[model samples]
Target: MLLELLLASVLGFIIYRFVYGDKEETLPLDDGWWGPGSRPSGREDESIRPFKVETSDEEIKDLHQRIDRIRLTPPLEDSRFHYGFNSNYLKKVLSYWRNEFDWKKQVEILNSYPHFKTKIEGLDIHFIHVKPPQLSSGRTPKPLLMVHGWPGSFFEFYKIIPLLTNPKSHGLSDEHVFEIICPSIPGYSFSEAPSKKGFNSVSTARIFYKLMQRLGFQEFYIQGGDWGALICTNIAQLVPSHVKGLHLNMALVLGNRYTLTLPLGQRVAALLGYTERDIELLFPFKEKVFYSLMRESGYMHIQSTKPDTVGCALNDSPVGLAAYILEKFSTWTNSEFRDLEDGGLERKFSLQDLLTNIMLYWTTGCIVSSQRYYKENMGQGFMNQKHDRMKVYVPTGFAAFPCEIMHMPEKWVRTKYPKLLSYSYMARGGHFAAFEEPELLARDIQKFVGLVEQQ
Candidate 1:
């Protein structure tokens, strides 16, 4: 009897630890100041200021001169993009940028929506706030905060903004209209970079939470991909009550026991709660998950360790900067593009749109600051952060994009987001879903919102 009681007690303890531990807890909302100098004693500025994207003739002249001065080294015969951005294809992109791409017009498009900046945590946080142009009678739009990842700006959502804010105008369902707020992650584009060390995703989440509170939104929906996904997850972890719904195109749920079993073969993976779709996306494990990560993570290793060294060169040369950033656009959009001569860039995006993104980095001189984000987030180690161990209590939704660097199965997502209410396998898209397939992404967001509202 004593032995049986001890055995029962051990099993029950394990069950309780697995099922109840940390489920209802939230991350402590810590304070931070990222400005260069010491924190000011008085309250920081809380006023929002109107902002515009501007460029002078001198800026245009300097860009043209740099393009003209570019020296090309011929790519290996028939190398395609296997090694990197092919110099051969880069010449064509540079030619278009120098001769035809219009910066002033793109700038005008950038300013079409309402752009504003407000001081938060000693930084000028830049964001575009777009309200529904027209709404149905007796209905108000839902407030949604969408964040962009590294090497991407608020511009990624420009095409998707209209679809969400005015679905009826786009011939879609008008049931779920949104008041969209897309903010540049601090140090990415126009948002100011952190001067101090240890400014990680948790700090960003707290700052964005403060921003939403200042905007008079006590509750709002949040969405993101890449780094944005992690930051938004932190937000949900920090303040579960404030976040109505958490949606993501990508999820960082690796390094857990579930993921460790991925290498046990498809039969075991299926037995471990992975769906058929998950098996299909994750199998051929060596190529799809392991080697692919090894191949694509070189830039991450560099940025996480010694970003300033490379940032110096990228900031100094326009052509070099284009080659560095645009390479990710090519391969990340579709890994198979590496086999094509032009990296299949023109298939999904126009040269004008691509260069416009590159120009944001060039003009802002923010490449170094942006690179430092990787170091702060992952420089210490992965899976060691407090938020990583915490499960989010907010209702969550995930869109599993087919070619997103690495595939995240719904089973894995549910581990971190126990309240996951929707998980859709997106029809088509890769890392830059909003920029590449705006209509598809918008519809998915509507679908997720509908489900959340029903609950």
Candidate 2:
């Protein structure tokens, strides 16, 4: 117990140092105990245990029953996803989920890649670690950590995993093979949730960094989008030297001067260093930034303040959980998709793939803990943390998917990632870049790392 208290004090000091320490700052290699109640005596277990995703008939039956019993409100005539996951479309997904979506098969696919769980800070941190099947002689696989965000699971990278780990077989250059590690953010799925409050992206980054070191990696690359983007960014900030390179498909460059000039018209926006594509996507700034944030951020507002309240219903009702989670997949993948009758979900993702992700949350009953992350990070205020204001010094690459809900120009991404080495306007895809455009994302990662290697 005393050790746990000491751990807490040490973590606090580390964060304080990062915020107030000198310019030559480096985040501490602190330890923690995140298990429930009081931390146990003695050094925490450091063993890595192999894991497999499993499901039972009863669990499947219960989910099917919930789908059978769902009482969906009717979408107003001609109304699409504008009002959220349209009830009409939810029916199609629910029908497939109940009748044809095979959870057992999906579980097998999930287990195809090796998984491991190790205790970090008292919580069982779950991650999938995949090494390249075959490396050229004298070649060593690069370690890449891919993090997922809200309404997303490690499953987001399942398709992209094979590509990165075996690019030679995937018809892509084998110049940079990766041993990929995709960890479920604590409380996201198989990973154990923090017993106490205040576990946010920074804590996640620290845990993941330790996870790599424990797996025998002293330095590795990091890649992410959504909350994953922020978590990877924090890893770079906390331990820039440990990160060989950082890559992101999404960025949180809020309140930067680049965004501030967005409303000044494209002429002024260009003066601020935006590209013509940026002007095309960001003009009528009200519709793109202000109105979009206002319209889409309702969930953020509630989750940041009262996550448990909303998470209660979501955890209890599988259908309600799907509606809540899938809504983001629809709008985030392409805001315009929301105008379609089916919300255009299946255009980019298979129903089995989508439901498999939802099932991770549904089976684990982690909606509440996962929702609490928002409160931990944003409950205080957006961009209010030390890392939020700090610039990352590590070499960074960004892939700007055109259909991302809010268009973040290259200039905006560069402001936060000062060491931005590569930026690409992805030909197609949206927030779920890896899921929708695995080949494209994989190529970009390879391209970015290739440049870093050249340096």
Candidate 3:
């Protein structure tokens, strides 16, 4: 009995030591987590300014007339999709967009939000800034910058903006109130398109750091999903001191092909639940990963190889634009709804809200420029680019969405973001979490910041 008691005490002491002893030390800012890559030292070409957004009454009338024409014309019958085109749905959607979608109203709705444009690293970055209505008697409103990804816009946070900024009114203010700033990544929306060839993720990070500095935010929280995650990660790495914390919906790890192809034994263990703590610590998403990779990665292959060729067609044709964006809306949200025509978008979003995002791209004629994002980042030898580095030190929090096209399990995420603090498996939400599940996302964001702040 005494021996057994001693063994139990020893085991308890060992477990306690393992849990609490010799914790990982947070790195200092001077460690150069941003890496030592040479950033091009250049000035903005004053000659190339942001294009004037045509929001005049006459312009609105002209846009309505063009949409009306597309509606009146009968689309090609015998609707087809995926492999080719869906003429029937095309006609229906165009009719709804032209006759019912109300672009003028959407314009006004967009104007309702406080929008601003600022110059950053030779680009005019556009962002929506909404301040909380009330601040505690002594506290100033905290700034939070939310970024959107490709095939998405700042519109992703339209719903969440109100919830964050005026939480008392929305019954969530007590939970969390954020002075929200949602930016349309350069080349995505009102933001100025990059004038040069080499505007990749890391460059964006540096530019945004300068932006926050200009805005007088010595420190602020950052949040993003999709390519937004890339920018957030970059910001954290580039200037970890200025960035207070980062919350990501799509926490992608910039891993090489080595991590992509794990060994057979580890793979089997992940499936059979026989993987050891050491092995399981490394391999997170072994089960069902193969299925996701095979099913939803057609666009990656196409974009990586031939983006410009595809961008040209999408830019010119309105029908092509709808097809490209809508297809992703369907497949990415949930695989169960993969075969459905609408992709179950209505399950989380209204057709009106969905069309607003599409119309933004269509009207701006920036569809091609947006697709070029892929080309710029995925161009020849991009992975092997001299500036490529995967170390990030920002206080990072990640939400693992079950239905995301690419899943980055916690262990895998730790490889790229060694400072990762909080990891949660989101019960719901897919790629478009901010849009599809704002309440849940807001809760997670609050939790993430709260934990990091406490630390």
In every candidate, how many clashes are there?
Answer: 0, 3, 2
Rank by lDDT (best first): 1, 2, 3
Query: In terms of lDDT, which candidate is stronger, 1 or 3?
Result: 1
TM-score of each: 0.95, 0.94, 0.79
Best by lDDT: 1
TM-score preference between candidates 1 and 3, better one? 1
Candidate 2 or 3, higher TM-score? 2
- Write the residue-wise lDDT of candidate 3 on 238-356 in tens digits: 67777888888876553422243343557654664432543533344443454555566677667766767887877766656776787677667875665444445567777688888
Q: Report model 2's TM-score to 2 decimal places.
A: 0.94
Q: Please, what is the whole-model Cα lDDT of each candidate in the order they appear?
A: 0.88, 0.86, 0.67
What is the alpha-carbon RMSD of candidate 3 to the true structure? 9.8
How do the residues 100-211 of candidate 2 rate in per-residue lDDT, one tens digit apiece? 8889999999999999999989899999999888775899999999999988999999899989988988899988999999999999999999988889888999999999
Ranking by TM-score: 1, 2, 3
For each candidate, C-alpha RMSD in Å?
Answer: 5.6, 6.3, 9.8
